[model samples]
Target: MSRTVSFTQMKDGTREEYELLRDLEKPFLRLTADRVLEELRRQEHVTLEGYKVTRLEHGLQSATRAERDGADIDWVVAALLHDIGDGLAPQNHDRMSAEVIRPFVRWDVAWVVEHHGIFQMLYYAHHYGWDRNARDRFRDHPCFDSCAAFCERWDQASFDPDYDSLPLSHFEPMVREVFGRPAYAPEVIREGHVSPLGA
Candidate 1:
């Protein structure tokens, strides 16, 4: 049998046991990109009820738009996976999706992903008797404009079934490259840097 931790409770674990677990976790961590791609494939069949395209197609179109707009890998990947949390956290998918990429992407990109839902409200919230200008509350935030542009340019415009979006194969390499980085590296995160929406 493979080696296993001996601790029955967290407090009872020894340093050696924790170290073993950490070492074993390395392989799983390395396959994060694979798991993420699997999630994206799952979206291929998951349409948002009445939308014209599947979630997977929406993501592909968004990513394709970002690429065509001269965006960097970070922005492109962010655009593609920004709505990934919709599968499990519909009401709070923005934040959940942000968390998935927060470790691998720039702080500004993660912030945009986390808050895009509210910014997106600018498009349809008023139809539901909600304030369309709710995003104005974040007007003072450094990433506010970026989030707005991301919504207007990529997210909201990606629902068309007729859009000629690039296939998932086109973005697989980008997703792998981003996820392959050391998680939460300070240089990668660039906490206070606000990269514009496009190159």
Candidate 2:
């Protein structure tokens, strides 16, 4: 399998546009039988996909959804690589996010990737009742409990139902992957804004 996908081919095939959008997201998001499987190397960690979560699948899904949602290139790329840190340790991914994204992307990428788990602190602490040690560790993380404002910013981002149901504003764009061209023409960007909540 190749690290690259023929994103253009997927977007233009003879299918309902929305369906094509979703179809493009399938292989990496569900990598068990992906065309790119051969490209992945075996690792010690177990991930949602055979490849580490950060390698490609989650990155692709986040970037793809981000573009459909109308986020900027930085935001989409942020979404794509946000979990890159998770490749190291799924439990505390932000630290790794900061490390990996900082090198390849930008400070913004490091910021968002670092904070993806910020909102989860409360989720894990209050309802899940993680032990004091675990809770303390989570709370101490730089992104822990800080995403409310970050989330607010992205909460205002636009989404396109024709391409995807997820909001894109919440993340940094990942235009690098599709920089040469787009999977689709970004018709939703042309049509007009759609609410992240409904669309």
Candidate 3:
């Protein structure tokens, strides 16, 4: 079964244009997967090593991990777009990624990527010495747990230093991939995803 990203262009029950994609729930979604793939493949970005990795490289690595883990397209896409907010300012990148991809990707995908940094913050918090309780206190957001699980499993090694290991431009299609197939649900996240920064 294919899954699709759902959205209403107009809130007044008016007709609106939207993109089509697939998910585990439904198998026959109306999406230009090839076009999205082409668009993703054409992106141009380099890694800190001066290697031309492009947004495609990041997406691929993330998606590869997600797919191997039995994830769906949306989850894969989320893995791909997890870093797309770097195109904007430092503090606003996540918001930027969510906003930019909201139109084309699933809400869940957008949320994960937009909140990815918080996961990193948690990672560093634990890594730096914060315990689980302290890290939870530091997370301080609704998306913290979900983002942390996303980071633990789907989020890949970011080769782009310009975007802090993960770059905003790398998140375009990722939003779609991840939202389609995620490793954890909100409940699972709330229950078991919190790993104290480094413990």
**Candidate 3 regions off by >4 Å?**
1-43, 48-55, 125-143, 156-199
Ranking of all candidate structures by their lDDT, best first: 1, 3, 2
Q: Give the C-alpha miss distance for residue 91 in model 3, angstroms.
A: 4.0
Candidate 2, superposed: residue stretches over 4 Å from native: 1-56, 130-146, 149-199
Query: How well does model 1 score by local distance difference test?
Result: 0.95
- Per-residue alpha-carbon lDDT of model 2 for 8-109, expressed as tens digits? 765555445556556777654443212112222222133455333324444445556556656655455555555555555778877775564344443434
RMSD of each: 1.2, 15.7, 10.4
Model 2 Cα shift for residue 33 (angstroms): 23
- Candidate 1 Cα RMSD (Å): 1.2
Q: What is the model-wide C-alpha lDDT for candidate 2?
A: 0.44
* Clashes per candidate, residues 3 or more apart or on different chains: 0, 14, 39
Report lDDT (Cα) of residue 28, candidate 2. Answer: 48
Off by over 4 Å in 1: none
Better of 2 and 3 by TM-score: 3
lDDT of 1 by residue, 40-82 (tens): 9999998879888999999999999999999999999999999
Colliding pairs, model 1: none
TM-score per model over all chains? 0.98, 0.41, 0.48
lDDT of each: 0.95, 0.44, 0.52
